[model samples]
Target: MTANTHDRGAPAAPARRSGLGVALFLEATERFSFYGMLSILLVYLLDVRGLAAPRANLFVGSFNALALVSTLLGSRLGGVVLGPARTVLYGCAIQFMALVLLGLSVMWPVLFLPAAAAVAVTNGLTRTNMAVLILRHAGGGRSADGLATLYTFAVNLGAMFSFLLVPWIGRRHGYALAFGACAAGLFMGAAAALLNRRALAGGASGGTARAVPRAVAETGLAIVSYWVVLNFPAGGHWIFWLVTSAIPVFWAWAWRNATPAERPGIAICLILVAEAMFYGMFDEQTTSTFVLYALHDLNRQFSVAGVTLFELDAPQIVAINAGLTMLLGPVFVVLYRLVDARFGTVALSVKYVCGSVFIVIGFLVLCLDTAGGAPGLRAPWGMFGAYAALSVAGLIMNGLGLSVVTTYLPARMRTMSVAVYYISTGLAMYGGSVLANAMGIGRLHAATPIPESLSTFHALFRGFTLLAACGAGGIVLLLPVLRRLERRAG
Candidate 1:
């Protein structure tokens, strides 16, 4: 079948478009709720729960990593047992309950870890399946690229609102209110999914009985591994290493199983996932290290005529990145279409390389800010530049990464490939956590002088800039191979 042809069991064009709209709504809501909670989680843990910076960073990082890694199990269950549509509904219901528990944890305190775990696990089921729904609704065609861009726009739009609103609510009312708002968003998503059930029909059927036992076993192992790493932060890097090391083995298995025509596409997918790990490492700092920096160093107050109007909270500062992404997304989408119209489809490798360079530039901007001898009141323009660059990098890297999975992989592999892509990010988040800790920013207390921490932050930024530069150079070296693979796949 051609790329433009509808999948075997897809609905008619009009129905499919309707389904796509519903899926996008669900995606936006889910992201809004999930990211809203995350944007405030570090502060909640530190201020409300009375945890130190190191521990709070670990908790946030582990939560993100576990949520992503568990997608392996979610993919198996969604693709083989429950089907994507059913899995999405179930995930929404579970996520709602998890958010409620998180709200309650503000009072009880003991419920915090378990509530976080619930949110993480349920995320595995929802994130990948929602993307699968979008792909199915797109009829798995060339339009998938445009739809993927729209999908990313929806994600950032929801995140932008949540990042701005949730943090404001948390700052004014309480963290519990923020959590409650997230739960409300999830409830809306669930309602939409239920109301549009017929339009979202026809996903994978339950697999053979023999496959069930192994799926259950793999899920059990994945959960146990996450538990151990979460409990033992010192050894978490090893766990992430173990998880990431399996990528090659999984790729080899997929390549061997695939037909000759499919191998090139599979190869491209693997390369993109690997490249994305570096991007994820840098990008995730917005929620962790960057938030801390803004809280301690950035001058977030707005003043006119020597009168302060409002001051931005740390989490709200993080929202600037999402807000910028929302603003920039449409411009990039139009630019990509124009390029594709004049020239044929752009190679995924080229986009990946461009994103890497942007990441390097973003981190360099941060590095320069750190070196500028600003004590506790660094200028916000440096952060603005960094956020803008990172937003563009994400629009290119993450947006196109999802498009590659949906466009190239077969139906049977699509969900699993999506899951693997997420796993790469999981590893990156964990890696970023380690890097954050090494910078010693976690050791800074409320009374600690900002100048004392400047060198450490500067060093960290310079290291990341170097790392991203090396990654971009490596991709450039492999461009010949990547282009060959694209041609073979075509």
Candidate 2:
């Protein structure tokens, strides 16, 4: 494990595992509440609220970007004055209130935008606090990977509930009811943190300034490109369930060794080319093209709940991936541990690559199912296969891969580094939306029936296939550079 001056004055471990468990529970609840809201957001805005697709997507992306910034700012404040635990509690309160307001916004309507932004702020603060708590609980490096994977599992579980339950319920009751559910979740999450406050605040006493050299800072800053490449695809996946987003994030991180500045420019250029290909290939499943196909070309049903409940549209189908992850999360973790034990450190890169490959294959499966319009009939089940692959792939890609990045990055750059990592993801989401818009998928109005969207699906998939190819090529080109850098750094 690597060391930083920050570890020097850290205190002794808490006397009881119960205390740590309480903290973990609080953190996990917070993740659940936040992701629960996120799981339903895009569909809510674009479908239920009667907003334009592009505008809705743009709003969601902008809000997420703001939240990312808020997290960085909140982390600094938590580190210095309020401390991580207290800041987390504060964030919880904000989240609770924001969710309540969001529910109210369903009635007021004009307040929805602000309510969404407030949720972002709450998440920013909450995530920062949870990060600090996680590191503290792990006692530096001991359980870093396990903790990260667990946190992600909790998030995916929360998302799954929101995706599966909320959508089904919302179809009958209305979007407002869904927001109310999220509000309840936020309150529970906040209450959990409040209950565990005493335990989380027990450690870490004094804060001391440490000197960091400019050269090292520069090296860290320069690494943002790699971070961006890694996060872009993941972000797309999360925001839109653009499962293809996994391609860039996983490939970049797996090929991290090749990212050092010592590598030749031509080699790096080739790597970027491949990354672009992978990203393109991966994007098809999430774009409006997919949405169009699901509504128009595929067989769909409406629920007989008397309220006109739509049954399993494309967005909802993508949302089901969260459920798949939740069910399989623990199993994946155990399998991952076995692999890690067998392969040792190389397991990290292996998981990263495997995750990306899974995502690529998922996209390929999607292309095959819909490519020639088999029977010229819509099969929602085909999309289900793609989403299932994505869910499992995301477990390997983001869940395991993020652990490696968080642990491997130097300490001084940790928070900033994560911020950069997320920023790339944010940008890619916005970029994918724009690209989808260019292909005419983003302009679809609620009144537009599904049958008109099949071509859009085909176009989006073709683009995604190209992106995946590029990302794969990027990994190959960066191989020599990665080998050299690994030898030097490792």
Candidate 3:
């Protein structure tokens, strides 16, 4: 958005190497530390925390959804009242305390919800701010999309290691130790940014700092009120409703001030937000139903050069997907550039179509492999193959939304536009939750001793395949119109 003039005759701005490293490290640490804790959370709730599948899934969905949705509010707070630096500082401190509290929840159990909520709040404040800082200092040395791609790559790098390391710690040492490790990693990441805080300077112009204290107090009160509501008999239902209610609120908020020139681009952003729900559901398979399947159903046995290794299980299998993302990221970037050169720039909608197609392919593999295995364990290839395709799709969609919106949306609304991209992920979590509850996937029936993880997941995976196919079809149908809109908006 800063005119991205690397190709102009003017000399490209120099890279702030330390700032760039801190930003990338911060992004990497977030993925590693956050996913390290979360990859185990579903099972932790179901078994260690002694909750039923429905409740476990709901809790997982609720916390993750809350985390993603809070970014809108967090971005507003950072871009305005509290200032981005102070917001990051407070956010990291909150997350550190949250990790500690969640670690303590292993003993008390009651502490988990508030801690989870705090993590949600932390998401609002910190992660998106990191991207802003990266763009802030990246200057003409890198394109904005390249910075976005680098951040995605950084995520997988962290995830690749965290998935391997943190889970082992969780399994061998103690659950609490794993969480504590995550806390330490996040703390270190925050410290890295603190060391280079001056580099993260712009973007806090709108509201006065005097508003910070009152806003924090109001936010605290709201959180406490929401927490109290969550403890009620039908709390989860109300929470889902509460979030769904936010969709239109965000739409109006984002578009209310848009000029006619920016309207089409903003409209496309919202459409992408909706389309993301499908992929989001697909994306969540790793954490929720996929983990459950690995636990109760899959034949996870494997050998490497006749040396027996740890059987692939929940987070470990999930780690394999992250590894794929890391490995495939650069390859896709090069391929995309080559394609762009041969053919003119690929349309953002086209990339999304490819993403949806790949998701369908992944689900189809799952459905085909899981066929007739309602009572047993199929080869791990089904799971492995599914992730292989989905990982590619993930890379394609990475900077597509942010990069497009950044290009076309008014600069005044940049933070909110970025926040809009996250709304899809937020809603995607809820949609997965809805799919789980409505269809009985991963739910344990009270009358039967056996949990229906395999059969339910089979049906659910099949349903997802259909949904993704429809999504792809819908996108393809709209390509002509979207292309016209993009040209007009451009």
Report lDDT (CA) for all predictions: 0.80, 0.56, 0.71
- Is 1 or 3 the stronger prediction by TM-score? 1
Best by TM-score: 1
- Which ranges in model 3 have alpha carbons more than 4 Å from their true place? 1-12, 137-141, 202-212, 222-226, 229-234, 253-256, 304-310, 373-375, 445-453
Q: Could you estimate the TM-score for every candidate? A: 0.92, 0.75, 0.90
Off by over 4 Å in 2: 1-16, 139-142, 205-297, 300-315, 373-377, 447-451
Q: What tens-digit string does per-residue lDDT give for candidate 1 at 142-233?
A: 36667777888888888999998999999899888999999998788779878987666543454556655675465446545555566666
lDDT by residue (tens digit), candidate 3, 116-190: 777777777776676666655434545555666777788898888887787778788878898898889888888
Query: After TM-score superposition, what is the CA distance of residue 454 in candidate 2 from its true location, in Å?
Result: 1.0
Against the true structure, candidate 3 reaches a TM-score of 0.90
The lDDT of model 1 is 0.80
Q: Which residue pairs show collisions in model 3? A: none
Return whichever of 1 and 2 wins on lDDT. 1
Off by over 4 Å in 1: 1-8, 139-142, 202-229, 302-310
Sliding window of 10 residues with minimal summed lDDT for model 2: 206-215
